[model samples]
Target: MRIVIFGGTGFVGLNLAEVLLARGHEVTLYDRAALPLSAQRSLADYGARLKAVQGDITDVDTIDALVAEGCDAIVLGAAVTAGEDLERVSPARVLEINVMAQIPILQAAIRHGVRRVVNLSSASAYGAAGQRHQILDEETPCDPVSFYAISKFTSERSAARHAELFGGDFLSVRLSAVFGPWERPGSVRDTPSLQFQILAAFARGEPALLPAPGIKDWTYAPDAAEAVAVLIEAERPRHRLYNISSGAAWSALQWGEAFAALHPGLECRLAEPDEKTFIKLHGGDRAPLSVTRMADEFGWRARFGCAESAAAMSAWWMQHKEWI
Candidate 1:
């Protein structure tokens, strides 16, 4: 399969590219930013299997031309993720990137020979639907709180509508807290993961400053990538909106403790957030994402827990030292 991923230089796209390349797929990564030097070094082993191409996603011609290159499937991983800072500074840009850009991207995919189209959505779309502790399934109502969430929800519906009218297989996957290799603080996605923070603190010999009891269903990047690969390769998928997550809940303290255990005296613990600083976990404890649908239908499940995932990331960071 030859796949062209928009925003392929970004965090999730990089991870997904590696997964597709490992599975013997040719990947053309189109992104606004060039692949970071660190990523180039890390993925050098893949050689010709992966190639990063820079282009403007909002341009329909660029999208059409890329798809015309003969792609098996197209994954729209391009978007401005959840971030208050981004919303405050450039709310309209968020919509322009996440929602408006989808129009041409989707049109080009169907216009070309691309079979399956995957739009990366976010669980933050749940918003107030996640106010309580209950696990959210595919059918859960999404009440977007922030601009990012709003764009994600709207994009999912909009793409589905387009697919209905144009006739094609389109999917919107609501991803949980995804973090691991290739995931760094970026302008498109600035939210830092608790695991990465802890690891960084250990490396710097500093105490990790975390929001108290930050808990959510965190999915490792490789696991999320595998689930995506499965969906892309599936001959027949019954649903359009699917949630890809670790399928289990974990806390900031747990990950901090796990890292501390591996490297003693890291002082991994939570710190109360003042008005200016914090990690927001307003969804409360154990806000698990119900992966039963993915498991039951596609026979897919997340393989790493918080501890194991943190350890794996630690090894990766050791090899790719410049990422942290």
Candidate 2:
């Protein structure tokens, strides 16, 4: 199968690109930025099976031509994450990329006869309602608080409305707590991940300190990529929206302990109990997204838990230190 990832050079997109190639599918990554030389060298062995191209996703004709030229499906992985530290970046740019950019992309997908379209939405769409867990299922009403959250929810609605208007096959995946390789601070995903902090600190020969309240259901990159791969391969999707995740929550203590055990000197410690940084990755129900729908419909489930993911990611960063 031939698949095109719109933001293929970013962290999640790069991981997804590798996974799709491993599945023996031809992948063409379209992004505004160039991939690092290290990543290119690591994936060089894939040869013609993998490709990275520089293109503007907002360009309708280019997308239409690319999709019409033998692309099977499209995965919309392009977006500016939550906060860009406006002092160093523009504020409205986030909304511009996350919310407004989906219009032309969806139009091209529908017009080009693309079979499947997967829009990468975030759990933030639920806003403060499900921040503390609340077993935030797909049915939860969206009350987006932050600009990033509002954009994500709005993007999903746009995709659904477009599909309804044109009778096209478009879907959205609400992903939560996803962190792994190929992810770093960039134009698309600017937030730093806990895994990267731990491993990067180890690489710098220092201990890592994390915020309090512990995080849960952190999805490893390879695992998240594999789940998306499975979804893309599904012939007929039962639901337009599916939550792809580990569907379990864990604390920073678990990951910290795992790192301590793996590397003698490296430590993953939580912040002071009274520290205002006592941030919770999940809320209410303390559960991430429920993968029951994905499992039932497409036989997809996360294969890695916190412990396994920690160990695997640690080893991976060790071998690919350039990524850290």
- By TM-score, the best candidate is 1
The number of the candidate with the highest lDDT is: 1
Local accuracy of candidate 1 as per-residue lDDT tens digits, 102-215: 888888877885799999998888877787648899888777888988999999998999889998789989998888888777777767777666666666767777767577
After TM-score superposition, the amount by which residue 55's alpha carbon in candidate 2 deviates from its true location, in angstroms, is: 2.1
lDDT accuracy of residue 35 in candidate 2:
75
Instruction: Evaluate all candidate structures by whole-model CA lDDT and list the values in order.
Output: 0.83, 0.78
lDDT of 1: 0.83
Per-model C-alpha RMSD: 2.2, 2.9
Off by over 4 Å in 2: 84-89, 131-133, 272-287
Give me candidate 2's TM-score against the actual structure. 0.91
Clashes of each: 0, 11
